[model samples]
Target: MTEYWRVKVDPRMCVRTGLCAASAPQEFQLDERTGQGRATAEVLSASEEVLEVAESCPIEAISITDAESGKAVFPPDD
Candidate 1:
């Protein structure tokens, strides 16, 4: 079975960099009015591109977790 991931973008931490949308347009987008990075959906099929986008966030605003297990995937647990 394909794994799924929960994607989240912290509005407080997001700086409207647009990197996430630029890197993974299919999975992320920038709000036109708020200009904040947001996940296209709360959950999506796991992919390396999504993980990369989360890791590449300059402010670490994006986070990903295993949808089933709720385990941290990006900014991995210490």
Candidate 2:
């Protein structure tokens, strides 16, 4: 059985800092018209690069979560 994860960016919260795209070029990119960073696709595996992107989001717009559990991974549970 394979597990998956997904990346979410809140459009309302995003300020287009470009950190997400810069940090995870393989996973995120800027929208052509909006110039805001967005997930290129749903991530199927965990990667430290993705976590760094989420953490670097100045507005905390990026989030990564278990596809099934819907629990946050990066930024963790404090």
The TM-score leader among the candidates is 1
- What count of clashes does model 2 give? 0
Candidate 1 — which residues are off by over 4 angstroms? none
lDDT per residue (tens digit) for residues 1-78 in model 2:
125678888888899888888877888999999989899987646777777878888878988887778887855767
Cα displacement (angstroms), candidate 2, residue 58, comes to: 1.0
Clashing pairs in 1: none
Count of residue pairs whose backbone atoms collide, per candidate = 0, 0
TM-score of every candidate relative to the true structure? 0.95, 0.83
Over 4 Å off, model 2: 1-3, 75-78
lDDT of each: 0.92, 0.80
Worst 10 residues of 1 by lDDT: 1-10
